[model samples]
Structure formats: C-alpha cells, structure tokens
Target: MPATLPRLSVGETVRVAVGVLAPMLAQGVIIRRPGVVSLADSLDTNRHACRILGDLRERYGAGPVLLRLPVRELAVVLDPDDVATLLDGSPRPFTPANREKVTALRHFEPMGVLISGEERRALRRPWNEDVLDHRESLHRLHDHIVAVVAEELEGLLPSDAPVLTWDRFTPVFWRIVRRVVLGDAARDDEAITDLMVALRAQANWAFLRPRSTRRLRELGRRLRTYVADADPQSIAGVVARTPGVPGTAELGQIPQWLFAFDAAGIATYRALALLTGHPAAMAEVRQEDLPTHRGLRPLARATVLESLRLWPTTLTILRDGVEETHWSGGTAAPGTGFAIISTFFHRDRSRLPWADEFEPAIWDDGRAEISRALVPFSAGPAQCPGRTLVLDVTSELLAGIVSQFDVAAAPPVRIRSERAMPRTLAHNRLRFHLARRAAG
Candidate 1:
C-alpha cells in the first residue's frame, strides 16, 4: 500500500500561506496590482517563498504535502517528476480548472478553455490552437505583426526623450496589443481595455468578491464588434473566420487572449530589464542582423524565455484532480487542488545549476527543453495555447528596440551580471535609457 501524503504542521502551513500564497494573491492573481508589485519587489517575496518551499522539501522529502486549509485540501508539489505527472495528466486525472482559478477567471472568461468542462474544452482548445498557430514558431500573421511592431515602436522612440519608463511604455504597448488581437481600427480602443482591467480587478478577489455582469457584458459587446469587423489581418479576424461548434464559446476565449497579452507585456518589459543588465547577452542580440533576420530570432526568443523563467508572471500554476490518483507518497482523492509554486522549481539552487543566473543559452542548447520543471509556458495538453504567439511578438519587439537604441537600465533598477539575478523584478519601477544608434 502507498504511504499517506505528508501533512504540513499548522505553523509550517501558516508560513506557506504567508510566504507563498499571500504574496501571489496580493500581487493580483488576475490583473497585476502595481502597488503590490512594488512592495513584493522591495520585500523579495519570491526569494522568501523559495526558501520556505526549500525547507519544506528537505523535511518532507519531495512532498505533494497535504495542506488542510479551512475550505479544502491542497497538495503542494515539490518534486520535478510529480510536476511532470500533474502537467502531463492534464484534463483527465488532472484539470487546470481548479476552484480558485474558475472562481477568478469566471468574472472575465466564464467559458474559457482553461475552466471549461471536458466537452466544451474539446471544441474550444482546437479552435484556440488553430487560430493561435500553436505549431508554428512564427505565426501565420507574422508579417502583419512585424509591421505592427515596427509602426507602434516608431512612436515610442522619440529623439527628444532619452528615457523610457513603464508608464510611458504601456499605452504604446496596449496599442500594439489592440492592433494585433483586434485590428488596426481598435488601436485607439482604450475603453475596451479599461473595461477588461476593471473586470480583472474584481477577478483578483475571486470568491471573496461578486462578479460584475454589467461590465463583463460591456466588454463582450466591444469584443464582438471587433470580431464581426473581421479585419482579416488580426487574431480577431482568424477567430471570426474559423468555424466553431455549438459550445465553443468563441467570444469568451478572446478575453483570455487579451488577459494573457497583458502578462506578455510584463514579460517583455522584464526581458528589456534582463538585456539592459547583461551586456554580454545584449551584445549577442545585437550580433543578429536584426534588420534582415526573419525567422525565430533564437537569441531574442531565449532572452524572453529567460525573463519568464526568472520572474514567472503566472506565479502559481494550479491543477485540480478530477479522480483519485496515486502518487509515490499516497493517493489524492478526487477534487484535490494541487499547487505548483513555480518560483521554487525555477530557482531552486540544488536542482538547476544556473537557477540564479540569467543564462539565455540554456534555451538554445536544449537544456531548457530537457528540464520538465522549467515550465515558463507550462507543459502538457493544458499548456498555454498562446505560447508561440507571445514569444514571437516579444522577441520581435525586443529585436526592434535593440536595433534602434543602445539600451541601459535607468536609475533605481540595477541588474548586474556578476551578481545573481534578483528573485523579483518590479517591471512597474523599471526604466530604460535609450540612446539612438549611429547610422551604418
């Protein structure tokens, strides 16, 4: 018979709650809270959480440690193999639609693939994959996206301004988002994004807060308008053109794309910080004949991946067991929620040799692929469908920025290569000083 799953002591449970769970919630599970981000960065919350998880692992021996919270049972996965097991068994024994996730996402994307039932997921997932170009490194709309990037970026880089702050970068970033997902016509549609932001703010509260149906309806109407327009050059167009089944929730899925792109923006900004801090890596990116480089842009893509590894935007990856599943330790009953504290796996010194460093080459050398634990975009059937699109857009955006300017980290945000990378990077506080590149 299998052994019973190890249980965390009450005190240890409290430490996990405060050190691990609290920060994720405070940082905003759905939409980021800028103020909380600043605080988390100052406190180095990821570092603290990693330390706590490490201690738990050492004591419990790679536990899916059972935590008996007041409401339900949660297993904190510690081992890489178990992480693989959880992710690989997705939508069957394990489902991404955990209670907390459903509670939060329902406010904005009630019929989204992430939280959908098995029947609904079958239809929605395929539609999402096809429209997103899941198998392709460069999307079908790659040229259009590249053109959008080049056009939007031209406005971002001004001769007079030597510095770029997050505040200054955001509006331009959203314009790119609007153009890419909706259409060129939606480029100035800030009100649609505002409604999303408002709904997401409520999502962060999850079960604690009530859903705002009025605002959700408003956001839906706006998205449907863009979809109906079917610009033929945007993701909305692809969605509009694609044939859908009865329960596909086509409109519902688009919000998830918009929500996800917001995180991609954070990752992109953080990647800029990583490049500014690491001159060697930046130099490698500069070596690429970026003007003519068309395909994957491997080095630039790796930089974005490294940025994601260092500071995972998803924070906590949750899965719920739909049926009884036996593990090395014991069997988890149906409806058990499993939480993977992503930072612990991404930065654990004992397991990953370069955990604390910014090493983009790991991605190119196949090290990142070999590691089941380094899930920047997650793994298995339920992994993010937008992974490729996000990477393609971000890498292209990076190439565009570096090709035009000599980038450096502005004051208050210092990323030094000699030292270990910070456990938390506050993208909100990050700024880049860009000097115009000399004519060839």
Candidate 2:
C-alpha cells in the first residue's frame, strides 16, 4: 500500500507541486502529466494526448490506475466501483460547491433549485417532461430537423462526390439544435448569436487557463454585463417562469450558468459531429443504422459517452475530501483537492468493451448495464439536470441527419484556435448527399 499523499491547498502553485509529485507516485503512467487531463496551458492537445493514453488503456486494464496528462496535475481514481461510490453515495460526500476549481459555472445560475438541490429536483422532471417526457414531440422535432438537413445538404453539395467535415456539418446541425431548443422563431435572432459568441469566447479563455479562476470570474462579469445589456428572457420563460431559477441574491450567478447552457450547445454537439463523422463510425451509421432512426437516442447517448470518455470537455471531476480519506490504499487530508480525469476514466475501453468500435449497438438496450465510469454529463446530485433533454436532442438530430442525407466527410473543420488550448472550429463542416429514405 502506498503512503498517504500530502494535503494540499487549492491555490495554483500548490497544484503544480502536486503535478510534479504525481508522476513519481503514479510511476510511468499517463496520468502523471497534467497535460493528459487538463484543457489548459497546452495547444488544446488534450484530444491527441488522450489518444496516446487511449493506446495505453487499450493495453492496460481501464481500472483504478494512475495516468499522466499533458498539463501538470495529479490524478487519483479508484476504478469503477469506487467511482460509483463517489457518484452515487449518500450525501454524495464530494459536493460540487466543495470544489470551485471544477464545477462548471456557465450553464445555468448556481442559484435557485440548482444550488439549493431542491430546485434541481423540481426543475428536472418538468424540463425532461417538455423535452424527453413527450416522445412524440422528440420524434416530430427529429423529423423536422432531418428534413431540414436534407434541404441544407442539397444546397451545399454539388451533384458530385464530396467529403463532409466538421466545418460544414456542425453549423447545419447547430441550426437544428437551436430550432429544437428555442423553436424556429428564435433560431436566427442576433441576440442569440451574440450571446453564444460571448459564451464561446469565455470558454476558449477557460480552456487556455483552467487555473485562472480570476480570469473566469472576470469572464463571468462580462457575461453578466451582456445579459444585463440584452435583457434577455428565457424561451422557457415564455412557457413557464424559471420558478426555481436563481433568486435576486443569486442573480450575480445567472450569467455563469447561462454561459454553460450556451457552451454545451456547441461544445458537446461539436464532439457529436467529430465522433459521428469519424470514418469508421460514419460508414456504419450511414449504411446500416440510417434506415432505422429507432436507435437515435441510444446511439447518440453512446456517442457522447464515448467522446466524453475520450475527450472530456470538463476534463476532470474535482472533489474536496470530507475527511481524511483512503483511496486505492492512499490517503489525503480533508479539504485536499481530488481530481479524476473523465478522459482517462471514459476511455478505459475495457469499461465499455466495444468502445474502439463506435458501434452504437452496445447502448441500444436500455437494460444493458455499463460500468459507472461514464459520466460525460457528470453524476450524483450535481449531475447535469438536463441530461435527458440534451441526450434526446443530440440523438434525434444525428439520427435525423443520417436517415435523411448521405453525409460525406469534407475538409477538416475550421476553428478559432486558442494559444495553448485546442481551437474551437470556425465551423463544423460536412458535404452532403441526400439519402432516399422511405417516409417515416
């Protein structure tokens, strides 16, 4: 058994020191380098970095083990069993509020039911009700998007063979997502565009400097200013008041969560584009699964799970120890920051067994049990409240596209590069050939 690791504070320098020591203790593992797990201070190389680790997990058991990432941070994981304990345990021992370093603040205000926990529960049912609870609604929305995709592809594709890439694919899909979320009326509004642009810019900055809490805070303030200036109202607000939305005391937090909402719209969806279009995965779906949009939800969920496993957008899950803790025979003082890379945890293909194949079939049966390692949308009480809604949206959209059009790989998607972090593609481009599908 290894000795107890030292207790460290939450500051930057201390975090770096942890990075240095982690490698020695973790041995020649991939998690040793912070770059392997961090989305900051590198050339957005974490994707490629995880690919390297993917090579390792392909060899090693994807069980509780140490790894080295490109950035400089220490990681400790207790395999899938331990992960379940962390995620599904009572009181969830490790709460999001405990670790400001890792909690995503850009989606919805941390106020109201989200922060209170009660509001989170209340909002969860309704949001899913409006989105997922109504299966017919999801199908109708999916069919609409699929039809639009066929039309868009017709406009974009020449009457010749073309390669579809992220640049062409993502924008068309983004529009589809917007229509689903806000309805067609809100799709082309400049206000939405400006809001998304600002949110993306802030995420780009966060990716470049994960430890710059102050910078993120400033970005939050700027976002608040944007909202204040725009005086935006929620589309849901049109449907119902955000009863559990943040209170006046928590009004300051609205922009941060709002930013997260916008960020997920693109970041997660872009990942969807990349995964679905990967040559191997694309061929199967286009040829085989395209006929039946039946598995769209399961397939899309599997896709996001795989992508999150490989290129975790949040990168790491941060936890503050409730007490002197023991993990994998090592201990940390209470309050010490404990981070586990979802990138490593998710890619441990052994967990998914069929991970390398990209066959969405593995997730088709709702009854098929999966290892607890998959947490793209996160887990426990603080788990993404909108998980069902997002999954429904992405799955239906992908299914709709594949069922309607013969999407071909185009040029590599173009993105706006952040200096150290990976660039956000200028667009998710793809060339398209219309598919001849029987009426649904």
Candidate 3:
C-alpha cells in the first residue's frame, strides 16, 4: 500500500498561509495593487515564501504537503516530478479550472478557457491556439506587431527627458497592447483598459467580495464592440472570424488575452531591468540586426525568458485533482487542490547552479529544457496557448528598445550583475535611463 501524505500542523499551515499564500494575495493575484506592490517589494515577499516552502520541503521530504484549511483539502507540491504530473495531467486528473481560480477569473473572464469545463474548453482552446498561432514562434500578425512596437516606442527617449519611469513607459506599452489585441483604432482606448483594471481588482478578492456586475457587463459590451469592428490586423478580428456555438465564449477569451498582456508588460519592463544590469546580455542584444530580423531574435527572446525565470509574473500555478491520484508519498483524494509555488523551483539553489544569477544562456543551452520546474509559461496540456505570441511581442519590443537607446536602471532601483539577482523585482517602481544612439 502507498504511504499516506504528510499533513502540515495547524501552526505550520498558518505559517504557510502567511509566508507563502498571503504574499501572493498582497502582490495582487489578479491586478497588482500599487501601494501593496511597493510594500511587498520593500519586504521581499518572494524570498520569504521561498524560505517558508523550503523548510517545509526539508521536513516533509518532497511533499504534496496537505494543508489544514477549513472545508477544503489542499496540498503544496514540492517535488519537480509532481509538478510535471500536475501540469501534464491537466483538465483531467488535474484540472486548471480549480475553485479559487474559477472564483477569481469569473470576475473578468467568466468563460475563459482557463476556468471552462471540458466541452467548452475543447472549443475555446483550439480557437485561441489558431488565432494566436500557438505552434509558431513568429505570429501571423508579426509584421503588424513589430510596426506597432516601433511606432509606440518612438518617443520614449526624448531629448528633454532621458529618464524612463514606469509612469512614462506604461501608456506607451498599453497603446501597443491595444493596437495589437484590438487594432490601431483602439490605440488610445484607455477606457477599455480601465474597465479591465477595475474588474480584475475585484477578482483579486475572489469570493470574499461581491461581483461588480455593472463593471463586468460594461467591459463585455466594450469588448464586443471591438469584435464587431473586426479590424483584420488584430486578435479581436480573428475572434470575430472564428465560428463558434452559442456558449463558446468567443468574446470571453479576448479579455484573458488583454489581461495576460498586462503581465507581459510587467515582464517586458523587468527584462529591461535585467538588460540594464547585465551589460554582457545587453551587448548580445545590440549585436542582433533587429531591424532586418523577421523572426524572434534568439538573444532577445532568451533575455525575456531569463527575466521570467528570475521573477515570474504569475505568482502561483494552481490546479485541482479531479479524481483520486497516487504520488510517491501517498494518494490524494478527489477535489484536492494543488499549489505550485513556481519561485521555489525556479530559484532552488540545490538543483540549479545558476538559480539566483542572471543567466540567459540556460535557455539557449539544453539546461532549461531538461528541467520541468522552469515553467515561465507553464507546461503540458493546460500551458498558456498564447506563449509564442507573447514571446514574439515582448522580444520584439526588447529588441526595438535596445536598438535605439542605451538603457540603465535609474536611482533607487539598482541591479548589480556581480551580485545575485533579487527575488522580487518591483516593476512599478522600476525606472530606466535611456540615451539615443548616435547615427552611424
């Protein structure tokens, strides 16, 4: 018979909640709250979480350590193989549409593929993949996206202001997002993004707070209008073209794309931070002929991947077991929720020699591919469908930025390459100094 899974003591559970779970909530699981983010950064929340989870792993010995939460069976996965199992058996033995996720995402994307039932997921997933060009690194709308990046990023380095703060860069980033996802017509549609922000803020509360029906409806109506226009160059246009049954939630999926782009924006900024610190990596980025390179630039893509590895935007990857499952430690009953704290694996020093360093070569080399734990976009069947498209857009944006200006992190946000990278990078507080390159 298989051994029973170890259960965390009540006190241990509370510590896990405070040390690991609470930080994720505080950091804003849905839309990041600025004040809380500043606090979290000062506190270095992720590092605390790593220590808490690491101690638990040492005690439990590669746990799916059961937490003592009321009215729910939950476990925190520690082993890399189990992480693989949980992700690989997605929407089956383990479903991505777990309770907390459903409760949260319902606020912004009620019918998104992430929280959909099998039938609806089957339809929506393929539609998302097709539209996003899931299999290809360079999206079908690659040229348009590159053009959007080039245009929006043009004035970022003005002669009067060489400083690039988050405030300075955010609007430019959003304009690119709007144009890519909703077309050039919606480039200035701050109203739609505002609606999304409001709803996602509600989502951060999950089931504790009441749903903002009025805001959600308004967001839906606005998204539908964009879909109706179906500008051929945008993802919304692809959604409009894709045929679906009544409940496919065609418009529903679009919100997630927009939402995911918000995290992508954070990652993009963090990538700039990483490049700012590591002159060697930035030098490699500068070497690439970005203007003529049509496909994803290898160095630029790897740098973005490294940024994600160092500080993953998605705090936790949660899944629920749909049926009874046996693990090396023991068996988990059906409906058992599993939490994968990605930072633990990504920065686990024992397994990864370069865990805490700014290393992009791991991605290009065979190292990152061998590890199941380095899931920047997740793995297996339930992995993000838009991974390729996101990488394409972000890498292009990074390449575009570096091609024009020399970047260095501004005061109060220091990234020293000689030292180990910080566990949590506060993208909001991040600022850069950009100087225009002399014409050759």
Candidate 4:
C-alpha cells in the first residue's frame, strides 16, 4: 500500500534473519517463528546486522531497510529525522503494543504505561509527571541499595578469590533489584525471582518446549500479590498513589519499573566497569565532591550516560503505524510497524557529534543535541517519566560501587552471553576483576 525501502539482499536477509531476529523468536514467547521480525542480540546478531546496515546505508543513502519475510514485514529506519517522526508525539497516534512485549510484559503488566497512542499516553502521564516529586523517598531508596551493595560485596569474592563481574555481580544486582522492588519483605524474593527465571527459561526454550502462558501469568500474579502486602512505602506504593494509571491494585503493573531492572543492573555495573577501565574517567568520578543527585558531575554522570549509549538495554523500540503516513522517504499504511533504533541514531554521524565514542562531557553540559539523539529512556511524549529516578539511582550506584571496589574486567573468566552492546557484559563472556579500595 505504501512505498518500500530498498529490498534487503538475499544474503543480508539470511544474515538479518539468523543474526538479528532468530534469537528473539527462539525465546519462550514466540510459539511459531513469524516470517519476518527482526530483533538483534547485540553480540551475536546485531553486530553482523549493524555492519551490514552500515554498509547498506552508505550504499542506499541513509533511509531505511525493509526486512522482507513472506508472513511478516519489518522496516528498520536508521535516519534520525525519520526516527524523530516516529517517536515524537503526533496526531496520528502510533501504538507500541507488539508481539514481543505482549509475550514478555503481559505477565507482569497486562498493559502498563509503556504502550502507545493517546489513551495509554494519558494513562502514563499522570504518574510519570509526579514520580520525581518523591525525591526524598528516592534518597532513601539509594541508601538502601548502597547498603545492600556494601554488604553483598563483602561475601561475594571469597576473601581474595578472583572474580569476573558477570559471575559475581549478576546475583548481587538481582538482590538489589529484589530489595528495591520488594522492599522490606525481600527475605523470600528469590522464590519470586525464580518464577521470572523459569519463565525466561521457557522463553529461550520456546522452540523445543510446549509453552504455557497461563503458568507464566500465574507466576506474575503471585509475585504481585506478594508485594501488595509488603512495605507500604515502596515504589509500588508510589505507583498506587499516582493520580492516573492502571491503578495500583495490580502489583504487576506497578513493578513494571523493575522490568528494566536487568538493563539497569547491567548499565550501572558497566558504568563501574567503564570508569575503572578508563583511569582518567575513574579519576574524574573519584573527584566527584558534589552529592550524587546533582548530575554527579564530570565522570559519574558521564559514565552512566556513556555506558548506556554503548550498551543500551532498550536497543529498539517499535511503533505500529495506525494510519497511512509518510516517513523517511517512504510511506506507511495502518498496521505497518516501524522501529526507532537507539544505536542507529545515537551512533549516527549526522545526529551525534561524538557518534561511537565515550565522552561524558556530552552529558556534562546537558547538551540538547545529545538529548535529541541518545534515547536510552526514549523521547517526546513517549519518553520515560522515571528518567530522573533512574539517572539518580544509577549515578548513586556507580558512585557507591566505585567508592568501595575498583571494578575492572577480569580476564580469563568464563561467562554467559556475549553481546554486541555493553549491557550483556555481565552475562557470561566478560567479567571484571575488582580490587577493594582502601579508605582515605
């Protein structure tokens, strides 16, 4: 019904299929592999596709790449101008409800504020607009996490045992997440997390195993029910009191903030790894005399921002074209799904002056261009409301971790997932060798 970008080469399609799309389909949610869907695992698939797309863009002049499959169709738009059109608020009201999110998030948040269009947007705004007003509570939250990290770091390394970050920090980060999400009643949080673990295992085994969405839904239900009865002042409480939302009755909906916990954990730890890896940066962070909240000047904020750019958790966010529209030299009819890829714009030479380099100073001055380009939390009306909370928490975590341990890559360590971006660094392939820092 609309114009198409240059068709993907046969070789490139296969590469895109295998590298960028298969891994996601192989997860528990995808019962039958669709003809076309492209979500890349940074290390395994996205790297290859990024290389291919980069070449294709240079050849085709920076528009979009249409991944053609008989049963499905996905258009990967790389141009920043086009991306802005997709993400920023528009009258047409594009929807973000996609299969992948339905599979993963429905269990936790049936329709949390993450979806698109005006109704959902209105649903999300009230809470997001006010999430930051509770800064005093966030300070307490930071103190709680820092205390956890301080205590957890002690027993993790086994006296002088060498540790890879992926191995050592993963559990620690999850524990902190549990505490944050579950609050005072985190004593039995592992049993709850076990449900998520099993669900993900099924997601990865979607290809071989008979799936059970009912069970996963039940698991999420249980976790929420558990949290509902926990501390009254938790993040869930904040979600409950918010003016407009899906209502706090569904604990699953409120803890949607924790859904990004994996990404947040990896990013925060990566900040530590990055800072430790870059001595000048580490020295800059060490010199942060300002309180952690006020942007944690120079290095801390830079490391968090830079690390996110390098290995963002939100690699690609999609929107379904609700009506026929023009975008990035092409046309989209209703139901056409387009992706706003962070790496494409963040690393694009046109939008970002830094492109693929780590310069904390980009964040140091609060550059408007960088704000427009780097979309780890997304932008415009769809932009995450929890930006301040996340940044503050992440900065504090980075500041807190580095304050205690000198985190660095631990060589010769066996790890989990090897990913393109930095988010998966803690999975398996890489690790950090941390040496405790003595007090001044």
Model 3 C-alpha lDDT per residue in residues 1-440, reported as the tens digit of each score: 66667888999999999988998898799999888888888899889999998898888887599999998999999988889989999889899999999999999899899999988888888888888888886888888888899898886976788999888888888999999999888999999999998889889999988888899889889888888987899888877787777677788888899999988988898999888888888888978875576576888998889888999988899999998899877999899999999999999997999999988889878899888889999999988999988998999899889888988888886588998999887888998889888866
lDDT of each: 0.89, 0.44, 0.88, 0.58
Clashes of 3: 0
Q: Report RMSD (Å) for each prediction in the order shown.
A: 1.4, 9.1, 1.5, 5.4
TM-score of 3: 0.97
Deviation of model 3 at 355, angstroms: 0.2
Over 1-440, each residue of candidate 4 has an lDDT whose tens digit, in order, gives: 66755677778778767755554345223121222212222354434545655666677676667777675557777666666677784425566665455445554455566643356656555555464433232433455545555565565466767564455766766676666556656644676666665555455453345556677567666666655575544555554444453442344344456655656766776676666556676766767776654433446766787777766557677776667667555665566667665655666655556655566777658763545657777776666656665666677667766677776666643221232233223233456766778989
Which residue ranges in model 4 land beyond 4 Å of their true spot? 1-12, 23-46, 90-92, 116-121, 128-152, 203-227, 240-250, 292-298, 349-353, 366-368, 412-427
> Tens digits of per-residue lDDT for model 2 on 300-395?
556555444444555566555555556654555555445555655554555555443334444555412465667776676556545544555555
lDDT value, candidate 3, whole model: 0.88
TM-score of each: 0.97, 0.59, 0.97, 0.80
* lDDT value, residue 337 of candidate 3: 96
Q: Candidate 4, which ten residues in sequence have the lowest lDDT sum?
A: 30-39
The 10 consecutive residues of candidate 1 with the worst lDDT sum are 286-295
Mark the regions of model 2 whose C-alpha exceeds 4 Å error after superposition.
1-3, 6-75, 101-165, 203-242, 245-301, 322-324, 349-355, 365-368, 411-440
